[model samples]
Target: MIPPGPKAEKLAEEARTRMLNEVDERRDPHTNATVGQLLDRYMKTLDVGRSTHGMYAKYLEKHVRPFVGRLKAGALDGETLDSLYAELRRCRIHCTDRRGVDHRTPRPDECDERCRSHVCMGLSSTTIRHIHFILRGVYEKGVRWRWVARNPVFDVDAPRAAKPDPRPPTAAEAVRIVDAAWEDPDWACSYGSR
Candidate 1:
């Protein structure tokens, strides 16, 4: 007793899709797995050096775990991943030095303190990209296991790497370097001869 029209067709489609998803979830062993659980399992199987393993653990706990740990694996999507990267780009942390001392203020002459932590502490693009890499690996595993339909990280735009400082050598400096090379007899015998 249903009227056939565009509205009815749309309703029928939605019902069919919902039922399909429900069935899929029922069959999926990881449908109930949280993001944190997935990451924990993935991390366990990952092979890395002692230092690198520590670094990965730190980043996972600080960034990804805080935001998406509780989210169901199947619920994740591209837009969700996009916002996570955007959050990482503008992330700020308390500027600190190797000794764990706060150095919030920078030297008046220096432009910025990326390597040295100060009040303007923030994660670099390289660091953000690294974090993304770890997540991508875990999500790909999820896809292969049929825990999720797709990897959301694939839909996200890549992080923008910071440009390196351009320091072209002066012509005078270049000439002095060449003059020094010619002055050395040992250099001429081994390298300059070729």
Candidate 2:
């Protein structure tokens, strides 16, 4: 209280602003709702076709709910979403450790030599992007409805689509294919070639 300077005034103003923001957030309803609840609410209000709605529910259940469902709708941030995306990229199945198991074997008696050890395959970038899309939609709705003040997903980046790696036939391969096709007179007639 004894400080008397421009800097002291600035510090006091910042403190007051921070306190006010905290109070506002505490009073927000979004802060009281979990991400899972938000997703459920969004799903219920969605107006897409039956199949599209089913697909959305499937994506949310398989990719999103287990990761951030328990988080507060208002508490999500770029860092939290980024971590979730990274985890999904590392393993689509969300493997806890290197422990191997044959997922095909429904029972111990059904175990066979064909059942191989578990392999971790990361989620496709496209699917992850879809998940991100669903999240963005949900959060945008929350912001529009005033349930949340901002959409945290707006700060996060969705995974980019993978580039196509095309492998055209080499010169020799093209020649061999032409020779093979020419050997079949029926193929020439089918193509209306003399």
Candidate 3:
């Protein structure tokens, strides 16, 4: 609903250009941009390896973007992020094929295991940590660009991944046990105890 004037014509032309272009530069760069908008900008500015960028993109697509996509970058609060992490910690991923087909097929033997419930497909703490890094990077950019006052990532704590405990090497210790089992005159001679 424009009043049909030179200003309206200029805005319409800009909108048309934005639609034709692959990049969405419709929003002004200096404004308090939305989380989704900033993510796109951050992704476009990545100078890392393709594989690394792909992984970051995957993390954004799979978790971070889906949750906070529409929220304004400046509007992100600690409580909202903490709540998102809580949900992510308990979230179960539905494994799918390249064709987007669900991988969970029900079998009689698997019924007892709740095969359809995806109990074992939950996102790991380490993966959630990765998502955190992606968000942190985006917000860091926001901070640098003066889009936001400061990064909100520092305000929340992500869950710690457990380190597996190391056990003594029983197989290597077995060789020592065998050596001790055969204490002989050769051992004494070797040490010049004869």
Candidate 4:
């Protein structure tokens, strides 16, 4: 019988090691699976529009991944989620705004002030409610996959979002507004004599 060459032996060994590693990873109870993994699974199951998937991926990468990427799939809990929310609020305030030209770094203290007094402080209740919804969905998937026994999000109460004041314009109001605009000389000039 011919002896196996070193190259052949190395290939065989690599194949065997890869197979074993895959099995081991699958069985590893404490293996870290980040929000990215959950997001992929969610995208597969969700019947939402592509826009929603894009939005969720953006939020997962920007807000969720940095804090929870190293945490084991089973290690997330209510307290951990709460802490993550706090961190997100803090980060939003301190986040660099490069809206205009000449990307200057705003003062660190100014950033903190903006975060605490405005950005963090003024976060709409609707935004907080949406965060709660995302967390609930993520943890629910964890439960479904047997990574978690129960959703931590189920145990917490999110603040109620303020209802938008319903202001459907009446037919008369609409007509009045339209008529006023049509009669205005400035409006006619701006709208090309329409």
Candidate 5:
């Protein structure tokens, strides 16, 4: 029964296609999976250098997992992610504003009075950007897998990249360095301009 226009026909067809896709998505268990599960699955399939892979795993474990690990992938929104980032910025360890010993020893028996009290240190913007990178990739994969229709991360703003802050040696320190270099002919030879 009919819409005579081409545009009308196209719109009707798109609606029908979307309805069918929704039905299929409803039956897929991945649609209900949590972000943590998605991250774990993504890691298993990620292909990268050993060191990069290790760093990604470490970032996920230490940052993302502790906060929103239990949240459903489809349910996440930009606000939730923003909150997570804010908390991380406040304290990397998510400290309760209480003092605790920052233990260097794995075994408490090995711990001594020398262990210093923990200080809250927020992650740098660059490190936070790395976290954003990991989540963006993961959510993109989730979209492809139909776990989510859209990546929530697209709505969030990543922290700005940090600029390098360099400090040149003081004149006194530079003089000391020159003095030491000339003390040995071999050191002087090694200090030549490239």
Candidate 6:
């Protein structure tokens, strides 16, 4: 068999060196990917219901992405996660509520009396808990991927939501309400109720 020429030999040697460098780069301990990288991988691996995946993506973008998306996965400690959680709560409280028939934006002063009473226009505990849950799930995924040492959510306590009061109407109150409803001329007369 004829021997390879000098030009061919030089090209082959260069290609081999490039491949070895790539392998070494992949093996290097110092070249770890970032949290964002892992999140992308996690998103791809998700086999959840479509609605759930959409919800997760929304929370990730709104709450987690801006703060720690670029951070090294292994470097995100409990403190950082805790701070992010707090910020999310704050954001939810201050978020603008623009939905209504008139489409008019209500000023803080025009908000319901309850909303105007707090230092930081407060959110319901349930909403705060939901934000916490989202963060907890993301961190749990990090743990599974060996990115975080542990899920910080385990250490932090989620806000306690108040139970809805059970206030069934009394017999007398129910009778009064039904009578008033029957007396309403608009519907009652239309329905032939005297």
Q: Write the per-residue lDDT of candidate 5 for residues 30-106, one digit (tens) a residue.
A: 46799899999999999999999999999999999988899998888999999989987888878889998778775
Task: Please give, for residues 1-43, the per-residue lDDT of candidate 2 as tens digits.
Answer: 4277869978888888887886686534535888898999999
Model 6 lDDT tens row, 1-194:
22578688778888888868866755323436676776677788878899988977876766677888898866776687677766766654334454323212445355544443324344467766775786677667866665565566777778787799999999999999878878787877776754
Worst 10 residues of 5 by lDDT: 23-32
Summarize candidate 1's per-residue lDDT along 1-194 as a digit string, tens digits. Answer: 33688699888888888868977775444479899988898889889898998999999998888778999987777788877766665544422233443344545444346344233346788898898888889988988877776787887766887789998779999888888887888995787668
Q: What ordering of candidates by lDDT runs from best to worst?
A: 5, 2, 1, 3, 6, 4
Model 5, runs deviating above 4 Å = 1-30, 169-184, 187-194
Badly placed stretches (over 4 Å) of model 2 are 1-30, 105-109, 166-194
User: Each candidate: how many clashes?
Assistant: 2, 0, 0, 1, 0, 0
Two-way TM-score contest, 2 vs 3, winner: 2
Model 3 root-mean-square deviation: 12.8
User: What lDDT score belongs to each candidate, Candidate 1 first?
Assistant: 0.76, 0.85, 0.74, 0.66, 0.87, 0.68
True-structure RMSD, every candidate: 7.1, 4.9, 12.8, 15.2, 5.6, 15.1
Measure candidate 6: CA RMSD. Answer: 15.1
lDDT, candidate 2, residue 118? 83
Write down the lDDT that model 5 would get: 0.87
Clashing residue pairs for model 5 = none
Candidate 4 to truth, TM: 0.54
TM-score of each: 0.66, 0.72, 0.60, 0.54, 0.72, 0.52
Q: After best superposition, candidate 3 residue 170: deviation in angstroms?
A: 1.8
Give the worst 10-residue stretch by lDDT in candidate 4: 112-121
